[model samples]
Target: MATAGKDTTDASGGPGNTATPAIRHSKPPVNHHRAPRAATYSTSILPFERSPNGNILAAFCRAAYWTQGRAVWGALTASGDTKHCYKMDHARRGRAIIINNETFHHDLYLGQRTGTDRDAENMESLLSELGFDITARKNCTAAEMKSMLVEAARESQGDADCFVCVILSHGDDGAVYGTDESVKVEDLVAPIKACKSLAGKPKLFFIQACRGKFVDGGVEVVDSKGKHGQDDEEEMESDEVAVQTIPVEADFLMAYSVAQGYYSWRNREQGSWFVQAVVKVVRDNWRRMDLLTMMTRVSHKVAYDFESNVPSNRFLHMKKQIPCITSMLTKDLYFTPKV
Candidate 1:
C-alpha cells in the first residue's frame, strides 16, 4: 500500500517498453449516421498565464480524472481490499467527471490494452490516490461513451465543483472512435453544459486518440510580432472565483494532442504524447504553479519531446498546440498549502 515514492514494475515482464502508436491518417468508416444531440456550444479562446500561488494538488486531481488513472510507469501501485478504488470524484475543493471506454473490437490497434484488466488496475491506483471515486469499464460500445458522459455529469452535481473527462481510444474530427462505433464530440461535451451544479465551473477534457488521417506538408508561416503582455496581465489579475455564463459556456478548457483532423502520437511503450506531458508536468511543477501555467509547459514538452521514428525513419510532426483556456473563473486557484 505504498503511496509516496514507490516503484513497481508492471507484470508484463518488467515495464511495457513498446511505445503507444502515434496517430496516423485513416478515414472513419462511413455510416452516414449521426448521434443524438444533448447540448452544444462553440469553444472559447482565453489567454494563458501562471498563477501567483501554486495549487498543484488540485491541478493534479483534475488531470488524474482525465487520465483514466494511467500515469508515470509505476507511481501509484497499491494492492489489497480497497472498495471504491476505481472511481473519479472531487478532492478537497472540487468534484470530477470521468469517462473511460477502453475495450473496443478486435481492431488492429487499441484492442490488447483496451481489453485487458491491467489498464483498469493502473487507473484504479491512480484515482484512489487523489481521493476520487472512480467508475471504469472495458469493451464499451460507441454509444457507451455518450451515455456515460450524461451519467457522469449528472452524478457530479451535488458535491463536485469541476467536471473532467478522459477519453482513450480511436477518434476523428469532432468525434471519438469507440469499439465498433464512433461517438460525436458533441455527445460527450454537451451533456455537462446541460447539467446544473456541474455547469459554469471548469469543464476539462483530455482526449488521447487520433483525430484524422491527413498529414499536412511542411509550410513556412510568418511569426506574429504580437506581445505576450496581455496574458501576463490577466494572469496576475485573476483573484476571484470563476463560474459559468448564461449560455453555459463560460469556464471550460479542452486539451487536445493534435489539431482538428490530425493524429495524436503514442508509443506501445510510453502511452501517448498528451498523457506523458500531463504526468511529467504535474510531477515536476504541481507544487509550484497553477493548472493553466503547468499545462502550458506540458503542451510545449509533449509537442517537442515526442518524435515519430517509424514509417521510414521520418519524424512525424505535430503542430504547436497551446493548452486552450475557456475561462469563466473569476478568482485564482492555487493547490499549494497557503501560508
Candidate 2:
C-alpha cells in the first residue's frame, strides 16, 4: 500500500460552506421525563495494521504526509480491513465520557447551547463506532462534572485500554463553565489522573469551549502539483513485542478546539466547529489512522477550511479556529472495531 506523499479530495466537500449555527434566546422546555439514552450502534469495521503486541509500527507512519495542495479528504479509504482498536494485556474495550454544558442559570451567561446537543449525539455515534461504552451527561455543574469523571474512573482499574472525555461548554482560560460556575480544567483532570484503577491507560480529553477571545487569519500557501488522489491503507505489522504498563497520566492527550487565549466557533445548526470536525475525521478514518493523525487532519480542516460567517460587532475580522493537542503518549493509539 502506498503511504507517502499522496493527495486526496476533501471529504467535507469544501470548507467554510456550512451555515453557522444560531443562538437561542429562550431556554428549551425542561422535559419532566428525560428520554432514554441512544442505543449503542457498532456496525462498522475500522482497523489498522498494528504490531503483534498491539503497538503501532511507527516506522510505517513516520514518513506519511499530505501534499501541499490537494482536495481535503479522508486519510484512509474503504480499502482497509476492519479491526476494533486494541491495547496489549494492559487494556481492553474502554469507556467514553461526554459532558454537554448547554444551559446556565445565571443571566450573565446566555448558555442556550443550541449546538451542544448535536455535539453530544455525534460524539456518541463516533466513539461507539470504535467500541466504547459511552456515558453521556448533560448540563453538569463544576462539582457534578468532577463526580461524573470519578465514577467513570472508579472502575478503570488499569484494565481498560483508554479513557475519553469530551466537554462542550462556555469556558475561559484554564477552565470550562458549569451551570453555576467555572471549573478549572486542571481540577477536572486531577481525579482522573490520580485514579489507581486507570494507571497506565491512555486518557483522552476533547474540550470544545472558548479558550479566550482570539481568532486565526488564514495565510496563503503553495500547493503541490500532484493531480492524483491515492489512499495507502495501513497494513498489519507482524512484529510482536512485550507490552508493559506505564504511568497513569503519561499517555494523556488533550485536544482543545482553539488555541489558549482564543474563541471557539459554533453553529446553532451544525454544532461547534471543533466537535463536528472531530467526529467527521474519526468516522471516516478510525480504522485506518491513529488518533493523533486523525486529529491533525481535523485541525487542518477546521483551521484552514472553516470560518465563522456570523456577523459580529465586537470582532471585525472573520474568525478561524484550530484544535490544539497536548500529549504525553508512550505508544500510538489505534481504535479498532469488533468484527
Top model by TM-score, which number?
A: 2
- The C-alpha stretches of model 2 lying farther than 4 A from their native spots are 1-92, 223-249, 311-317
TM-score of each: 0.55, 0.65
Which digits, one per residue and each the tens of the lDDT, describe model 2 over residues 48-87?
1232323223312321322210111223224332122235
At residue 14, give the lDDT of candidate 1: 16
**Candidate 2 — number of clashing residue pairs?**
21
How much does candidate 2 score in TM-score? 0.65
Candidate 1 regions off by >4 Å? Answer: 1-103, 106-130, 216-248, 311-333, 336-339
What range of 10 consecutive residues in model 2 has the weakest lDDT sum? 233-242
